[model samples]
Target: MRTQIAIVGGGPAGLLLSQLLNRVGISTVVLERKSRDYVLSRIRAGVLEWGTVELLRTAGVGERMDHEGMPHDGCYLAHDGRMFRVDFRDACGRQVMVYGQTEMTRDLYAAQDAMGATIIHDAEEVALHELDGEAPFVTWTHDGKPFRLDCDFVAGCDGFHGVSRPSIPKEVRREFEKVYPFGWLGVLSHTPPLADELIYASHERGFALASMRNPNLSRYYIQVPLTDHVEDWSDDAFWQELKRRLPEEVAERLVTGPSIEKSIAPLRSFVSEPMRWGKLFLCGDAAHIVPPTGAKGLNLAVSDVHYLAEALKLFYSSGDGSALDGYSEQALSRVWKAMRFSWWMTTLMHRFTEHNAYERRMQDTELAFLECSAAAQAVMAENYTGLPY
Candidate 1:
């Protein structure tokens, strides 16, 4: 098969990129290792930066989101038994949409189908060929048969463990990583949210987040040790532990129920530099990762798509590669800023093994400063809503 662009993953990044490109008369194919059902079943971050919402709309997939997604103007930060709200709209003239990533993926898939874009799922052993040269292609297996895809450029949206990033020669690629000492034990349930907007609590015990997919479905997470497993905590136990970490008032009114889904996710901050290496470019988790504390995961993917999609359009239209040439640098500039914000939020909210009393006090002090100072609140709001594309 021949196409203008070959996308290595069918997740939100790859699908969104394909949808965006196809809308502009570009032909692209998406190859996914997992089944479509498997991809949609994966639950991910729900917070959406305003820019991400706009991108989804531009991709022709935002109708459902705009209809069903809740708009959040502020979120609460709880520290030392009191909670303060950061008004994002007031501070930065922007608000985020609380739409689950799973829903976003479904919308993208529907849009792709409407556009008649080619998306091949259950593709296995995908490999890149001659990405360093002018001509590049992708090879993979589907239903025990081998297939080859010829394309002008390859996009590696396959994620952290996917083959696309590793295809770049190790001698040419440099990675920076930091694994946090804790993980997030998340619980999903069909219960009313504990509050109108999300609450991020920083307590002496640990950190806890109260979020929602809709008014009837809620998602919550509490910091845990790396050693904890899903079997180690029951729904009742998880609720008890979570309550202990939240403020008394919020806890008193909090609703508890059986967890529909439960999992533990390790926190980490990682980045792979030079997102573009020759004809192959990396997007989203293929190139970087951030802790969930900052809700930057999917937003980062959208931003990368913004840069790469625009660059590819320019390349195909005017035969100019300047934007394409600057994809890596342009994407990395925003990537590093987001990485810093996620790291800072993780450090301020979670309890670390090495945190001394001084460090704990420092966290509380920072929260206090954030509550009292409009400048600090604006800074947080700006970063939380998103930086820019």
Candidate 2:
């Protein structure tokens, strides 16, 4: 098989890249290890930044989102039993949309199919080769049949476990990692939202986030030990701990029904330097992962694919590789900026016992200052809602 580009994963990154390319009359193939349903239903990021929503709307996938998605002007910062809101619309002329990753995946999947793009699901044992040769090779097995795929370029949209990064020469690869002591125990329930906008609460007990997947479905998360098991946390146990962190005034309103599903995700910051090597490029979690506090993961993935699609379009149109050549550095500039924002938000809400009493007191002061100062609110609003993509 041959294509202009071979996308290694069918997640949002891969699908979006394929869609953009197809728009410009480029052919690509997407290979996914998971089945189509699994990829569309995966529970993941639910917040869509304004920039991402705009991009999706331009790509013709935002009609459903614009109709079904809930818009939030800002989020609430609840600490010490007090709540203050930072109005993103007022500060930055931007607002976030409460659209789940699954929905975006489904939309893109439909768009890709409508455009007549090739998507191979349940692919197994995929491998990349000839990265240094004139043409790159992608090989995979599906249903016990092995096949070889050749393409001009390969995109490793696969997640962290994908082999794209590992294919890099050991001597040329550089890695940066930071693992947190905490993880988020997330839950999805069929309950009306307790709040109109998401509430990010910081308490002595732990960190809690209240968000919505839709008008009738709510998605929430609470910080827990990294080693905690999802099975070990019973329904009663989940609510008991959640009540401690969430504001008491809003606790009663947060309806806890028989949970539809639950899971625990370890918090970590991971980055693989140089998102591109030879004929292969990485996007989304494949290149870097940001903690979920800032809701940047899904948005970052869209941005990466946006830049990548534009670069490829230019490459084919003008026969210049300048845009592709600068892909890594250009993407890194925004990646690092988002990294800082996510890290700051994580530390501000999460408990760190390593801090001395004086440091703790200083943190409290900073929070209080941020709550009242317009300048500080503007900073959070711009980063939270997103900057121009």
Candidate 3:
């Protein structure tokens, strides 16, 4: 089989890329290792940066999101038993939408079907060949039968564990990573959210975030040691711990319910340099990973798609490869800025014992500044709402 681009994953990043290309008369085939139902069942982050929402609308998949997603103009920050709001719209003229990733993925799938794009589920042993050459191809097996797919380019959107990054020779690849000492123990339940907007709290005990998918579906997370497991916390225990970290007033109104989903994700800042390797351009988690503090992972991946899609479209139209040649350096500039922001937010909100007295004092001073200084709040608002693509 032949296509213009062969996408190696069917997650939001891969599917959205294919959707954008389809609008411009580009043909793509998406290969997924799991069934469609399995992919939609995964509970992931719900925060959507404004830029991401715009991208979806341009791709013709934002109709449902516009109707169902909640919009937040600002969020609250709690420190020293006090909560203060940072108005993103006033500070940056932008606001984010609270649309769950699962829902967004569903919309993309519906858009793909409406457009008649090809997506193969249950694909196994997906492999990329000759990425450094002009005529690259992908191979995979379905129901024990092998097939070959040839394309002019390949998008390695299969995520962190996928083969796209490993395909780059170790001699040419450089990786940078910092693993934090803690993880986020997240719980989802069908209870009313405690606040109108998200609340990120930092107390002597640790960090806790009160978020939501909608009015009734609440998503909350608390910091835990790296060794902690999901089985360690029962629903009652999680609710109690979360209430303890919140302000007294907010805790008084908090609603608790049985958790429908529970999981733990380690915090880390990682980046693989040179996002492009010949014809294989890595996007999203494949190229870098940021802690969830900044809500940048999914948004970053879509940004990569935006840039890569623009470059590829121009190249195919005018027969110029300069944009493709500069894709790595251009994308890295934005990636590093986001990495710094995520690391900064994580440090400010999370409890780190490794900090000395001076470092701890500095953290307290920084939070205090953010509370009173309009400039600091503006910076946070711009970063949280997202930087220019």
lDDT for each of the candidates? 0.95, 0.89, 0.94
Q: Is candidate 1 or candidate 2 better by TM-score?
A: 1
Highest lDDT, which number? 1
What TM-score does candidate 1 reach?
A: 0.99
TM-scores of the candidates are 0.99, 0.98, 0.99
**Against the hidden true structure, what lDDT does model 2 obtain?**
0.89
Q: What ranges in model 2 sit over 4 Å off?
A: none
lDDT of 3: 0.94
Q: Please give the distance, in angstroms, between residue 171's alpha carbon in candidate 2 and its true position after superposition.
A: 1.5
Evaluated at residue 182, the lDDT of candidate 2 is: 93
Winner on lDDT between 1 and 2 is: 1
Better of 1 and 3 by lDDT: 1
Query: What TM-score should be assigned to candidate 2?
Result: 0.98
How many pairs of residues in model 3 come into backbone collision? Answer: 0
Rank candidates by lDDT, best first.
1, 3, 2
Candidate 3 residue lDDT tens string, 1-389: 99999998899999999999999998999999999999999888799999999999999999999999999999999988889999999999999999999999999999999999999999999999999998999999999999999999999999899989999989889999999999999999999999999999998889999999998899999999999999999999999999999999899899999999999999999999888898999999989999999999999999999999999999989999999999998889899999999999999998998988888788888999999999999999999999999
RMSD to the true structure for each prediction, in A, is: 0.6, 1.1, 0.8
Per-residue alpha-carbon lDDT of model 1 for 1-389, expressed as tens digits? Answer: 99999999999999999999999999999999999999999999999999999989888899999999999999999998989899999999999999999999999999899878999999998999999898899999988899999999999999999999999999899999999999999999999999999999998889999999999999999999999999999999999999999999899999999999999999999999879988999999999999999999999999999999999999999999999999999999999999999998999899998989999899999999999999998999999999978
